[model samples]
Target: MKNQFFAAALIGLTAAFGAHTANAQEPQRFETEAHAIEVTTFASGLESPWGLAFLPDGAMLVTERPGRVRLVSPDGTLSEPLEGAPQTESFGQGGMLDIALDPDFADNSRVFITYAHVEGDVAGTAVWRATLQRDGTPRLVDGTQIFRMNKLSGRAQHFGSRIVFAPDKTLWFTIGDRGQGERAQDATDHAGSVLRIDRDGNAPADNPFIGTPADDLIWSIGHRNPQGAAFNPWREELWTVAHGARGGDEINIPKAGLNYGWPVISYGRHYSGGKIGEGTEKPGMEQPIYYWDPSIAPSGMEFYTGDAFPQWQGNVFVGALKFQLLVRLTLDGDKIVSEERMLEDLGERIRAVKQGPDGHLYLLTDDPDGRVLKVSPAS
Candidate 1:
């Protein structure tokens, strides 16, 4: 009788625990779309490709993680790596990251980049804007260091480093927690937060914590190590893919002034199976729209709004570093109805997914000798 009573008690406790943690996880779905198209490799022998931006005149700009930016022509030819790219620490995960073109690139020739800098024991990330010359050289004429974080500690982890411009012309940038466990919720700290700023790198007056003592550039707080960010095609919402500790990679729809419930609530524990954050539920915290258990280590993301694949229009394409695959999420009006995995046989870690100006899909392979690949119908 005593044993039965103890078993009942344990079951009840487990049920209560699962109740709080259930919604925080997405069941693993392993279906991949059959490759109706052949995957063609464009250029190889390039260094670790982090990001790619296409130019209006048919050239391409690619950023290497080791602090070089190269111009590639439409025929997969590489131009000489640009000079005057910002010097990066190039430590373990610390180096150059995302690259983006100004929305008014035709008129302004303005380009932006994010990178990790090490100054003594302190290492943090910064964003800068420069101008591209007519002959495809990048001369950083107005190199402005826009935003930075505290508590870098030179740990060589979690730089975040993805930048995207919203429809409203505001630039949103992600900053990782820099391996600091408790700093995600620190209002005064820029670590683990997504910030919205004007083109001049100043915080907007309407920012949530603008007048407060906290960092004024903050848009949404509580991120782990976000590496993927893109604007949604349907709603134009800002969508991000963040890495979790052991499991629990998350896809978040970030909004201003919201607390994203990092460190406070996670479905994953530490790699050693210890506790993470406070608990799963706290009042007034925002929950993720979707998350992954047994994490895929999501990297770059793009919304499939192109006309090439009519069936995939409006779906979300995310790159996986750990799994070395491509993940596609089929959303039924913002609710993830199903998920699929692709490119398992390719043995390449996907770094970025982009829609070319020709409405075809382009991807960057994340490798020491990465390649630019194009996906089209096999026929």
Candidate 2:
């Protein structure tokens, strides 16, 4: 039965792979030449802000790791915590995660959020979407539990919850392996995968593996714990950064139905100092475009197309949680020529990176006393 299921999945993957071949091409990787990167402390005395979203009025919505959401004004003043944030477990890496306004938020005022929920000492990841009210309160009138993890092992590690809306208006969400590596290979589980769904939380009919009598929300599998996710503006390809076991932190462009080769094939080792999988080179598994050897513990990612830095128009920006810095990856076609680190002096774990409405870079610090900082040219 296992063999039959695997064969059927492979067939679906191959067909989807062929359809995406024309859209697939190598990306430009540029050498990272040193430039003057000035970091400024925008706001202080915050409490572990994790997610960031911009409002049409030029203000911003920021999510706190301790289960609170706030509205930050353009003048850098923070509002009182918005009321009605869903209760979160908030232990370990679990808390309020990513936030994104609906594609038509200006008209609908719809908002989406991810968090870790606990029930009877068991914690799991969940995604919900609702509306933010005008009176500094979240109405949450249309709350929908769009997605949830399969198993609830009470593990506080690897709840990779990040959401990005594609240009096509489809939602692409990342799920962590949740410290159970073997479940990544399980077709019935949502862990360690990228799932694509419609605004209504329904699977698309044209999905690669849809109508195969299996859950069609899954777009790709074999990921460990991916926190950073974004769509490349130039090529419209989805890109992600995931934490590896020891080393081998990866930056991969996920292909539909392709196996990313997690514990089965990794450049990292077991936490207990054991071997992992059959090594890096395998026939069917996809490899990362750029991987870190010593591990950077990447969190959120964004592609720069703003006019603030003309030279960095196409550069990729990633937040480093463990390294406490921002990694700037320069692309020269399909290779990462160089990586530049910024904000090293601040000594804070960056949890998110985003492009503001005016085209400047905005960041959220992931510390207990976290703050939302803005990055721009040193004037």
Candidate 3:
């Protein structure tokens, strides 16, 4: 009887402590069109956090644009910047950008990262793959560069680097125009294109430009600065969101052997208010399935397929930097039917969005004191 009373007392003490902590970090709640929700900071103290990935054990891998990678725990604890991340340049639109776990991560512990690095006087996007060591001391081992842009320049902007793994085990990634619009139309250049390669950086045999003068890795070309990308599980297709000059931010289903029409054609005008290309349509170039006038400056994207909010299933979410809001588009089979803007009062530049393994939505705010905000159904 005495042992039972002691156990009950310990349980009560633990519960009280938990309740106090929860109250201290009280969640901010908001009502959306579909569901009322609560947003809580999941992790903090990150510097300009740009990328977020979930580990099998529920920890998170977040990469800061200032060239640091941190491991965050479920309970909001952050590990010191993991050692052995690839060297990076934090120039304009450059830095350690996106990260992804190998498809066979459970067995091999391999991982990949995209960063902006300089070679000679020119800077460009590069990919690094390594073995992630987590045996008490978290660090990367056997690090190597799997890919680098062959065509680089003095320009520092537009290092379009987002990594996505396809269903067939191949890796697909994007590179931007590096502030030069003409490069997007150059088939010989790797810039302004979606590229496909094996985990070891070898171009796949089935790549569209095998025997062509165009780079063997090129899958699609003529993109401006496609920063947001994902493999749509429901559609088995790859989609990307790219920045336009002034008014033509767009969403394109980047396909093999296709040209997306960047400098050659656009729905937007130049920043100086001049007309862009030959106008919004061209015969051979593809058009965007959806576009935004005046540009929301989208960075990260995700397709919600979770049960946390059943109402949000089949919806597409994009993080907007220009307006500091989360943009949700309801789709009727790839055709965006409507747009709903949320979190205007949060006053944070949402950088990346990830659907957590727990069926909740997570966002990385881009700031010196960045935070991982967890969004859940209020009810």
> Which of the numbered candidates is closest to the native, going by highest lDDT?
3
lDDT of 2 at 315: 92
- Runs of candidate 1 with Cα error greater than 4 angstroms are 1-35, 136-140
Report the C-alpha displacement of residue 179, candidate 1, in angstroms. Answer: 0.5
Q: RMSD to native for every prediction?
A: 13.1, 11.9, 11.3
Error of 3 at 298 (Å): 0.4
Compared with the true structure, all predictions reach lDDT values of 0.78, 0.77, 0.86
Ranking by lDDT: 3, 1, 2
| Candidate 2, residue 100: how far the Cα is off, in Å | 0.5
Number of the top TM-score candidate:
3
lDDT of 2 by residue, 57-156 (tens): 7888888766767777776666666656777745667778888889999898888888886666566777787778876343455667777766676666
TM-score between model 2 and native: 0.88
**lDDT tens digits by residue: candidate 1, 1-379:** 1233223212111101000110122223323374476577665556788888899976678887876777777777676667667776455676788999999988998888889865665678888788888554444565667666655664667889799998888899898888885788887888899988988888888889978888888888889989999998678789999999888799999888888888888877889998887766688788888888888889999998877778888788899989998888999876888888887877889988888887777889887767777777555
Comparing 1 with 2 on TM-score, the higher-scoring candidate is: 1
TM-score, model 1 to reference: 0.88
Overall local distance difference test of candidate 2: 0.77
